[model samples]
Target: MADEVGTYEATVTVTDDEGRTDTDTLYVHVEARDLPEALLSGPGTAIAGESRIYTLFGNAGDALLSSALWTLNGEYQESEDLGGQSSVSLKEKITFEKPGEYRLNGTLADEAGFQAQDSMNITVWSPTAHLLVTLTDTNSPVNESEVLEVDATVENLGQAKSDQPVWLTREGNVVDVIPGMELRPGETADVTLEWQTDPGDAGTHDIGVHSLNDTDSGEAVVTPGGGGDVFFAVGYTSPPPSTVAPGETVQPTVEVTNTGTATGTQTVVMLDIHGTPVESTEMTLSPGESRKVTTFSWTPTVSDLGTGDLVVQSEDDEASAEVTVQGSTHFDVEFASVVPTNTSKITPPGPHDWINVTVNVTNTGDTPGKQDIRLTRTVWPPKPTLPREQKDEVQNVTLDPGESTEVELLWWSPRTSDLQSCDGETKCYLIYTQLGIHSEDDEEYKMPYDRGGGGGGGNPPCTGPNPPPDSWCGTPVTLFSASEIEAGDSVGVSVKIYNHYASTEWRGVNIKSHHVSSYGPGSYKNWQAKLEADDSAQPGQKIKVCVTMESWAGSHLRSNYDPKAKAPAARKGSFGCSTIPVVDGGDDGGGGGGR
Candidate 1:
C-alpha cells in the first residue's frame, strides 16, 4: 500500500461442530518501505587543471541512514564518506582533476541493511588546439601546372571556446590563410586550400598548416611525365612514430628511389625548426632502385617538444614527414632573485615613501607551471605591522625550461607613530617574502631608517630649531665659513647668484638689497656693495655681488644660514633667492637660483 501505513486486524474462524466453536484474530502492521537512493549532482564538464565540486545526495526513505560512501574514478574515497548516522539523508563532496571522463559513484545504506548505488559521468576537458593536414589524393599523379587540394582540420579539445585562424603553407611558404572561426569545446573545422603546380614544381611538395600553438602537414607528389612514365620519388621508408617522449632516442629512415629510367642522387636530412640540418646522409639509387638511408639517431630535448618535419630531397624530387615530440608534465617554480635587492635602505623615510619589491620566478622544470607570491612587512618592537600581507597571482603561466618572469609587490612606509618605537634601534623593520611554490622562501631583509630617540650623554644638547639638534638641512647654497666681527674690524661679504630662467633674458638687473638677518643694525654700518651680471648673462647665468661692512657691535655670522638678496625690477618670475650662511672664519656661502 503506497499511501497507507498502519496496523490492521484480520479475524479467522474455524468451526467443527455447531458451526461456531472457535475464532482466531490476527493483528498485522503495514508500512511503506523504500530502498536507499543515491543521487549525484554537479557540473558534468570541467577543464583540465580546474577544480570542481561535486555533491552526492544519499537518501533513505522512511528509514534512518546507516552509512553513505563515495567513490571517484573507481577509487574508494574514504574521506568523502559520511559516517554512519541515524539521519535520513547524507551529503559528500568530491573534486576532480585532469581532463577526460570520470565516474562518481555513491552507495547509501539504510538501517534495515538495504543498500542502493548511483553514478554520474563527469567530463573534464583541457582546451587544446589540435591540427591535422590531409591531401585530397596523396597517391594520385599530377603533372606540372596541375591544381591540387589540401585540407586542414582543426579541433578544440578543451572546455573553453576558441577562435583561431589556420594558415596553409607550401614548402615553407604561406600560400593561403583561412579566416579565424569560433569553435566550441569538442568542435572541429576544416579549411581547404588549392594550389597550382608550377613548371619547376615537379616533385613531392609539403602542404602544411599552422594553427593555434600547433602544426600539421601532408605531402603531394608531382611527376615530370604525368601518368605516362615513372619518375624519381623520395619519401620516408616508414612514417615516423606519432609521438615520442622527451629525451627518448629516435631513428627515422628515408627512402630515395629512381622510378624512371635513370640513376639519381638525393640527400636525406633531418632539420630543426630553423632549417639547420641536425642529421643528414646521401643516397644514390639506380633506375627502379630504392635505397633507405638512416640519417642519424637523435634525442629530443625539452625545447624540441613540438611538431617538426623530416624531409628527403633530390634536385626535382622530395618527400616530407611530420614527427611529434611529447614530454611529461612537471610543476616547478623557484625564486631567482629580488630586483634592486631584497633589502632596501633609505634615510629617514617619509610617510609618503613607497618601496617596491620585485620577485623573480623561473620555470626550473621541463613543463610550464604557475605560483603565488606574497610580501609582508613586520615592524619591530611590538608595533602594529604595516601592510600585513600583499598577494599576487599568476595563472596559465607557460614558460620553456629555464625561462623566468618577475612579479612586483609594493610596501608603503607606515606612519611615524607606528615605527616610533624603533627610533633608537639599529634596524627598524623586517621584510619577509614568500614564493608559494614548493615552500620556497627568500632571505629576510631589513629597513634601517633614522628613528628619533635616545642619544649619548656626551654629545652637546641641540638648542637651535624644532627639528632637534645636529639636524641636517638641504639648500641651494653652501656656506664655507662664518665668524663674529669685532667692533673695530671691517668684514667683507661676497654673494653670488645664478640666473635660472633658461628661455628668457633678464634686463637691467641690480643687487637691490642685502642683509645678514642674524646681525642687528648696530652690528654693522656703512654697507656699500657692487653687483654685476656675467658678460654672457644668459639663462642659467651667474652673477656676483660683493659687499664691504664696518662693524659697530660684535655679532655672530652662521656659516650655514640663508642671506637675503633682491633682484632688479626688470627681472621676471620670482628669483630663487637664498641667503649665504656664515661659515668658519666669517666666510659667507654662495646661492643658486632658477626661474
Candidate 2:
C-alpha cells in the first residue's frame, strides 16, 4: 500500500485431487526490493550506564514470504519469520549502559528471492549528578521582633548519593549547619532553620542556604528579610476636605513609613464619615521606605452633613492614626409679582380678560439648587361666573449662587355678570404662588400667600378704566359631560372661543381641546361681529366656546387658546378667560359683541 518504490510478487501452488496431494510453484517476477528501515523507539540518547528499549520494523514487497533479520556491527544475532508476508516487524532492546556510539543493521527477505538491507547509527549519553534545593516559610515581610522560621528541601537527582553539608546563613553570617545528612540517588530531605531577625534597619534583607557538595556548592534564596531593627509606624494621610455638597466624593490617601531599622508588614484601614471602617489592606515596607498605602473615597447622600474621619492601623505592629474630614452649606426661595398694579386696571365683564403675574425664584444656599414653582389665581365662593374655575401655570428653574429669574402666570375670566358684579365685592381674587423645592437649583424665595392678610385685604380697591380692545384677550372655553366617566368609555367635549375687547384687533379665534383631537375657528367670511350675545345661555350658566370631544372614560378636559395672529392695531385691550365644565351636549351660548 506504500507509494515508495519497492518490489512485489504473487505465489501460486498446484495440487491434485488424489488421496495424496503434490504441489507445484509458479515463480512471479519482482522488482528490486527495499529493506525495512531501522528506527529507535526511545530517546535518541540515553544516560550512560542506563538501560533502554529499542523496537525495529522491516518493510518488504510481499507479505507471504518476507522475513526480518537484524545484525550489530555486521554480526547476525536475531531472525524473525514474518508469517509468509512481504513486511515484518522486529524489536531489540539494547542497553548502551555506558556512553558510546553504536551501529545496527536490519534486513528483509522475500519469497521471490529478493533481499533488502538497511543500517543505522546511534549514540549513548552519560548521566549528570546534581542537587536541587528550595526554601519554604509562612511568615513574609518579617517584623523586627518576629521569629523568622526558614525551612529547606534538598533532593539528589544524580548517579551517586550526595554526602554534602547544607547550612543556613543571613547577611554573610552562618546560622546553622545541617550535620550528618546524606541524600542518596532520588532521595530528598527537609531541614528547618530558625533565626530571630533583629536587623537594626527597617527594610529588605537577604537570607539564603548553601550546600557544600565535596568540592562544589549551591545556594538558594530562603527568607525575604525585611523590617530590620526599626519599627514601622502605620497611619493614614490627612482626611480629605469635608463639608462637601451632596453627590460629591472625596478620596483620602494614607501612607506607612518605617521609623525603625527593621522592615515589616503593616495593615491599613480606612473609616467613612460615620466612623464605620470601609476599607482594609496589607502592605510591606523596607527600611527607610515610606509607602503611600491606602486610599478612602466617600460620596455623600442628600441627607448627609457635617464631619467624618478615617483611621489606619498596622497589623504586624500595634500602631494607628486618624484623619479628619469636613462638610458644605446650602439654601433656596420663591418670589411672586403681579403686573398692572391691582389699583391700576378695571374689571372686565367677560372671562376673556387676562391678568399677568410673574413668579421669581432664587437660590440662597451656599450651593446651587433646582425648583419647580407653580402660579395660580382662584376666585373665592364657587359659582359659575364668567369662565369660573381656578387657573394654573407651572415653571421649572435652576439657580446659581444669588441668581434669580421670573416666569409669567396667566389667568382668563369668562365674560359673565356674576364675575363682573363680584370684582369689587363678595368674590375676592386670590393670586396663589405654590412654591416647591423641586431641587437645589431654583433662584426664587417663596413666601406665604394663603395667610389672607399680607397683600392688602385679599382684594384690590376700585381701579382705572377697562382695558382697550387692541390688547390680548381670551374667551370662555369649556368641556362638559353628562356624568363622571368610567373606565373604558368615551365621552364628548365642547369648546368655545369668544372676543370680549371693545376694539376689534383679532381677525378670528381658534379653540383647541387637548382631550379631543379635532378643533378650529368659525368658518364665516368677513363677518363683522358687533354687540354679540349667546341667547342660548341659561341662568347661572356662562357662555363657553364649545366642541364635541371623544375620549376613553375617566378623562379630564384640557383646553388652551391660540391666536390667529398678533393683536391688530384696532384691538389693544387685555382680557381674561376661564375654563368651565358644562353639560355634555348643551349649547354654551351667550355674550356681548363689538367690532
Each model's TM-score, in the order given? 0.29, 0.27
Q: Over the full model, what C-alpha lDDT does candidate 2 score relative to the true structure?
A: 0.45
How many residue pairs clash per model?
19, 107
| Position 191, candidate 1: lDDT | 64
Residue 92's lDDT within candidate 1 is 52
Candidate 2, residue 544: how far the Cα is off, in Å: 14
Q: Write the per-residue lDDT of candidate 2 for residues 1-595, one digit (tens) a residue.
A: 4454455444555566765655555544434544333343444666655665656655555424456777766777678777665444567666653445667776766666566666677775434444556675535456545655677777665667666556554554443455445777777888786544444423555666655321112332224344335455655465455356666676666667777665655444454555343455555677888887535566766445545443444433322333233223233434465433234444331335554556556556544555656554433223454333343555666666577676675644344444322235433332222222222433432222221112211212112344233222222233334222222222333323232223221222222422222122221121111112233533445333332111111111111111332211111111222333222333432221111
What is candidate 2's CA lDDT for residue 322? 33
**Which run of 10 residues does model 1 get worst, by summed lDDT?**
551-560
Q: After superposition, how far is residue 524 of candidate 1 from its true place, in Å?
A: 24
Which lDDT values do the candidates have, in the order given? 0.48, 0.45
For model 2, the superposed segments whose C-alpha errors exceed 4 Å read 1-144, 147-228, 233-243, 273-276, 299-304, 308-440, 443-500, 512-595
The per-residue C-alpha lDDT of model 1 at residue 8 equals: 82
Model 1 regions lying over 4 Å from their true place: 1-32, 48-55, 59-595
